[model samples]
Target: MTTVDATAIVVTHNSVSQVQDCLSALLSAGLPVRLIDNASTDGTPALVGARFPAVDLLVNDENVGFARAVNQGLAGVRTGSVLLVNPDCVLPPATARGLVEALRDRPEVGVVAPRLIARDGRVAVSAHPFESLTSVLGCQFGAALLPVPVRKLFSGRSRRRAYDACLRPGEPRTVDWVSGACLAVRTDLLLDLGGLDEGYFMYYEDEELCLRAWRRNAAVLYLPTVSATHVGGASSSPGQTWPHLYASRLRFFARHRPSTFGPVRLAVLLRALLGTALALARGLLRPGPAARRRVRAWREIYRIAAAADRTTLSQPVPMTSRSPSCT
Candidate 1:
């Protein structure tokens, strides 16, 4: 009911409370909203349906990975702009209106990411370049191995990267990729790029989408002017998802940066292998529900990539989700 030429789609797993809170915050700020529940056994769909009767809901039988869920959610959005958001994110009172206003001036922008912060008040990961092997591995191994700044040429963990997109007391600037946690973009452009390349199961799908948009002569902007506090990874335990995250990373490397196909992919694979081995060595690990499903989801990505010519997704999307809960 808020005056805007846009409709938003938020995807959720089992985090019913977080999704509810997020919806309340978003609606209070006056944005038309819809939801796509990625098959939750814990009654997330029922709760959302009963509480927010005005929202358009798509309840799946099982979890479809993030990209597909977002694609499913987008189908019902009738407005000019479409937002892809996670259920764990709560928009600041001014965030929605500001983002809509920002979208108006930048018609060529395929996607825009807002300044994201953590609940503990730290800078959440937002507004970054393509998460290349060099970049991801740099974050893992050491900053010295690579020459250019890791996060951003200007903003690594240093004074520059840290403050480059800072929302504390200054203005926002544009960047290569905005975090997928809370991203808004034009509805038409999103469909044009095929709706987030389900090739990326969990992470880096945002990067893939933004980069594709960039190549299409569309800009991916980082607006520090508006902000959202994302209680990051509510659906996942950090330790468990690491492997799938790496797998998705490897798939990204294989699918995109083909020129560096040999050494670069090898480097990232080795790093991920080492990290997983170390994670195993530590023994403080648990495979949560999302992680377990992502294992299969990422595998599906690889399969989809391998059989690129064989598969044609012409029909409507299939609804899916896991029956088991997380650790």
Candidate 2:
């Protein structure tokens, strides 16, 4: 009986309980929603279909990655705006409306995201600046070896708080990109930009979309007035998490930074390669299951870097009992 101008898209993969809770919360917002299931082995599709029949459901034959699944959901949207909410995120009442209103109030903003709060009530880092080769290198594991003060001074991780718009909750501000956990984007602009690049199997696709929007002179804004609870990393296991992350990083850098032709970029690539190699060696010599997982993740990173392609690590690494599972 409620009404909202935007269409909501919720993408689920192996999300059992989280999908139900997310849908329950979204129902209060009163927006038409499309639930896209990427071959989830769990009962996510059945739960949504049985309990929330009003939702438009698209079940895939296999896990088609996050970007592609979201793109498929986007295709069903007839509204002026679309909201991308992860299965693990719960949006508050009127939260979706607030984002849509922001877009309506400001014609220049192509994307807007609400502040993401953890279940523990802590603000999550949702907004971030664009990635550069130097910034990426500074965020690698080797930076942890530096003195605390020195690392804080130079590492990109240190500036994460500064870039997070949630820290300044009173006012809405422009940002480079917001987390895809709960982002509202103009449907027209999203279509023009080809939705998310299917090349990004998982991470950084949101960043790439916002970055492209900026290039087209559209602003990406972060409105902290509204918030969503995001239980992060629900889809990934520890054994394969780092691999997907680093592989996506490699893809983003390759797609955006001309590493092969530019001298500065080439130097940055060399530093990342050497640093990853040293870390992988250290992880191998270390003891325990955690250490072995680190080794596996680092080896995947090294492989992606060597191949200079994200597709090299496209397949999900098999996770065993020893691997940490996200609840």
Candidate 2 local distance difference test against the native: 0.76
TM-score of 2: 0.82
Stretches of model 2 off by over 4 angstroms after superposition: 142-161, 260-293, 309-327
| lDDT at position 13, candidate 1 | 82
| Cα-based lDDT for every prediction | 0.67, 0.76
- Which residue runs does candidate 1 get wrong by more than 4 Å? 142-163, 167-169, 284-327
Assess the local accuracy of residue 327 in candidate 2 as a C-alpha lDDT between 0 and 100.
14
The superposed Cα distance between candidate 2 and the true structure at residue 106, in angstroms, equals 0.5
Measured by lDDT, the strongest candidate is: 2
**How far off is residue 40 in model 1, in Å?**
1.4
State which candidate has the highest TM-score.
Answer: 2
Taking the tens digit of each residue's C-alpha lDDT, what string does model 2 give over 1-327? 557789888889888878877888788788888888888888888988899998888888887778877877776467999999998999876788899999999999999999999999888768887877566655653764765456446646535544445665878988888899999999999888877877777888899889989998899998989999999999768666666666677667666664532433344456556655765677668767766666566566666556664334332322122211111
